[model samples]
Target: MSSFAKPGSEEQELKWAWIWFKQFCAFHRRAVEREREFSADEVIAFLRSKRDANVPAWKRMKVIEGLIVFRESVQHRNPADLLPLRETMRGIVSIERAKSEGYDTIDDVVGKIDPKEPDAIQEFRRALRRGGMALRTERTYVGKLKNFMADRGLTCLADFERIGAADVEAHLTDLAVDGNVAPSTQNVSFHSLLKFFTLVLKREMGKIEAIRATKKPMTPTVLGPKEIAGVFEGLSGVHLTIAKL
Candidate 1:
């Protein structure tokens, strides 16, 4: 058999195994007993537990590989039989590929784009439509809300509760000052979010003193008394009386 030990090197893999041994003990709530030796069954159980906890697939696989090394090199036990079942190994590889392609988690695939799937923004859109809101208005409101959630990683309805006026003010203020969006666009996002909170969610966010988008001052077009009288020159009978009135 080929040499299993690295030449001129201390058994580092065995040391790593010792580290994981303590962790595994703690995980199972077992007391640290020096005479205890881990079994393949415990390793499989640990991996199953990690899977249920949503531990990243890649990280869990590393734990398995580490245990295999620990069993073979330290305990002088053949761990080939202890390797993950073929189906489970395939599943981990699939998850890794999916993650690399940007589908890192279930939430990413389900709740990101499709807002009609019983998620936070989806529920808001449903309520808006039921209230007879225009289709375009619903899209605009939900689109901005999705952008808000995407920026902050707020993936669900529960995340909305953590939001306060200050958070909203900061987001809107960024749009006006940093994003440099037109005053009208800023106003639309601002009012849309306000309506979402008050009407759809039935949560009141009192008056917000957000940074107001700059608007050109309107100079009133006042007509002088002489200019007004000139307007009556073309009137007749009742029309003239009504104009005078």
Candidate 2:
């Protein structure tokens, strides 16, 4: 257990710091006897993996900071590089918070995007761009792919290997049945999975057979002349102008 000599709430921070430090060291297979040293790659992998876990974003951010604190205070290592990574994580958390608050500026959305996205997903995105896919299509495919991965607890490229055709089929089925997705959305999801498996992962998944969503064709409600006149009967000002259109 890690303890701070200082009193008050700082103790809790120190405890979490110790926990993160210990977990980091253990995950890397560094024995207690060895002076624990971490590289940038290790730092990034740890953070990315944790983001996919059930851990809350706030706590994950704290864990990053805690590790930095432990390294500087306890290990006495110069963690200058780690500082930026921590700040990057902070930016992600802030962006997510802003999104939840309904701030959807292009800058905000771009800032929230992970620069170091998983290799498979990033490659798929690149492929989409290279093929001149529409911006909406790219976003849809990437979003669906992410949703599929998140559903299976996959957080990184290594985890993609565990995915197979059956997994893809099952995911599509779930989207149609449980997710209540439309046929178009289900089709997009399927194409996204196929591209990910074929182009990015370079895996040979046979033809995927999954339950598809039925397209709910929207029946447009056309108002008769009387109904339209009634709708605008008592309208005036901007409302009347809009109704006239």
Candidate 3:
């Protein structure tokens, strides 16, 4: 008989078992490493020691049977292949560790934010629209109000109420001097602020006059030949012919 086929050779069986155990460890190490935290050498050594002692022959056979079952469960299985039970346990332990450490579930750190007072700008604009202001006029007023808040770093309407006409005048002057805005543009921005403070904030902007008004230059009107011909000729072709008849 060949050396491997010899029965009752305890040393040879132990050596064969160790070889199978090493192969199992290699496969289990790869599986454990996929989990990002498990140390393969430590896990393999620990499991191998446990399997060699205290585990009964029937249980060991069942574990080996499970390995065969697992291998057969895949698309391909080799009858000659042998696998150790500890590898499967290592995979299960890795999974359990990951779950225990809270890596498995989605974190709750980003809770829902409350929609409250910070939404005042939107509310104010809606109120203005409901109050029958034209779309363009409402847009202009809201835009200026936003600019005022941005310029002063104001957070709320209450914060804006503390500002006086002097602040408004200063803002307009800054737009004219530093921004180099035209007098008409400055006047538009000024009026937009005045209207928002008076209507939306319910603040009295008493005697707040516009800085300047630019009268657009009038240009003479001209007519094209087609327009002039259409005006002079009136109806044409079949209509004209029918009318004459």
Per-model TM-score on C-alpha atoms: 0.40, 0.45, 0.36
Best of the two (1, 3) by lDDT? 1
Candidate 2, residue 195: the lDDT equals 79
Give lDDT: candidate 1, residue 131. Answer: 67
* lDDT of candidate 3 at residue 168, scale 0 to 100: 81
Candidate 1 lDDT trough over 10 residues, lowest sum: 104-113
lDDT of 3 by residue, 1-245 (tens): 64565576555544544444444556455442212332335444544654667654344454454434434433234524344344565444444433443334212111112245344465555565446455466567767777777887788766766788877877777776677777767777887776667666786765544344344546898888877667557868887666446
The top-ranked prediction according to lDDT is 2
**Model with the higher lDDT, candidate 2 or 3:** 2
With a 3 Å backbone cut-off (N, CA, C), the pairs that clash in candidate 2 are none
12 Cα displacement, candidate 3 (Å): 99
After superposing candidate 3, which stretches have Cα over 4 Å from the reference?
Answer: 1-120, 209-245
In model 1, which runs have C-alpha deviations exceeding 4 angstroms?
1-118, 215-245
Best by TM-score: 2
Output the TM-score of candidate 3. Answer: 0.36
Q: What is the C-alpha lDDT of each candidate?
A: 0.71, 0.76, 0.55
Task: Compose the digit string of candidate 1's lDDT tens values, residues 147-181.
Answer: 77776678888888888787778788888787777
Quality of model 1 by C-alpha lDDT:
0.71
Ranking by TM-score: 2, 1, 3
